[model samples]
Target: MFKQLIPIALIAVCTPALAAEPMVVQVKRLSLDTALKIAQGSIAACREKGIQIGVTVVDRDGTVQVTLRDTIAAPITVPISEQKARTAVNFNAATSAMKDRANSPIGRIDGLVMSAGGVPILVGGSALAGGVGVSGAPAGETDEECALAGVAKVQEDLDLAM
Candidate 1:
C-alpha cells in the first residue's frame, strides 16, 4: 500500500509542473534580416559621430552579411576591416585585444594582428555569428568603439543582454 501511494504522490507533484512549462527551442544565431539591421545600426552610430567608417558584418564562418562604407571613407578600409571582424569572430574575442597580443613577441609567434576593431557575435555564450569591424576612423581604438556600438545595437535588436 505504501509503494502504491508513493507512485501516486510522485505523479501528482510532477504532472502540474510539467504542464506549466512552456516549450522552448534553442536558437543559435540572428536571421539575415536581423544581421543587416545590426550592421545598419552600427553604421548609423558611426555616422552620428562624424566618423567616416567602413563597417563589415560577417557570420560565424566569417561570411559577409552586410557591409557599408561611408562616402568619404577610404576603399582599403573595407577588406582590412572585414578581416578584423572575421578574426574576432573566429577567435571569440575582440580583434583589438587579439591584435595587441599579436604585437607582442608571443603574438608574433602566434602570427596574429594586434589592432583595434573586431568583436565576436555570441548568443547564449555560443558564437552564433561574426561581429562588426570599423576602420578609417581617427585611430584603431576609434574603429573598435564604433564596432562595439554596432555590436550593441544588434544585441539590443535581438533582445540579448550581451
Candidate 2:
C-alpha cells in the first residue's frame, strides 16, 4: 500500500507539468502607413493612364485599412474596389485568376468579388499581410495592372520593414 501510494503521488505531481499550454504566436501585420501607400500607389497608377479609379487596401482579416477614390471616379467604384481587396486576402491569391473560377466551388462566396485588379500582399515568409484592389478601369486587365503597380511601389518597403 505504501509503494502504491508513492507512485500515485508521483503521477499526480507530474501530470500538471505534462499539460499542454496554449501556443502564443506573434504575427506581423500591415501598418496604416503601408496600406495608405499602397492605395495611393494604385490611384497614381490609374492617374498615369489618365483614368479615374478607386483603390482599397485590406488587412489579412479582410478588413479595410485604407480606401482612396479619385475625384473623377464613379461612386460605384468604392464598394467594388473594397470587395476586390477582400477577395484577394480571403484566398491569398490574385483576384485576376479567380475570375475564371467564379462559378466553381471556391469562388463567388463570402461577399467577395473574384474579378481582376486585386492582389495579395504577403510578407515574412508567406505570411499574408493584406491586399490591394483597384477599380474603375475600362478593362479588368488594366485594373490588375494598376493594382500590381501599387504593390510594386511599396514592395521594397514591405520586405525591409518586416
Best by TM-score: 2
TM per candidate: 0.71, 0.83
User: What are the clashing pairs of model 2?
Assistant: none
Whole-model lDDT for model 1 versus the true structure?
A: 0.74
Q: What is candidate 2's CA lDDT for residue 131?
A: 89
Q: For residues 42-80, what per-residue lDDT tens digits would candidate 1 score against the true structure?
A: 677778888787888888777888888888889988887
TM-score of 2: 0.83
* lDDT for each candidate structure: 0.74, 0.88
Question: With candidate 1 superimposed using the best TM-score fit, by how many Å does residue 59's alpha carbon deviate from the native?
Answer: 0.4
Model 2 weakest 10-residue run by lDDT? 18-27
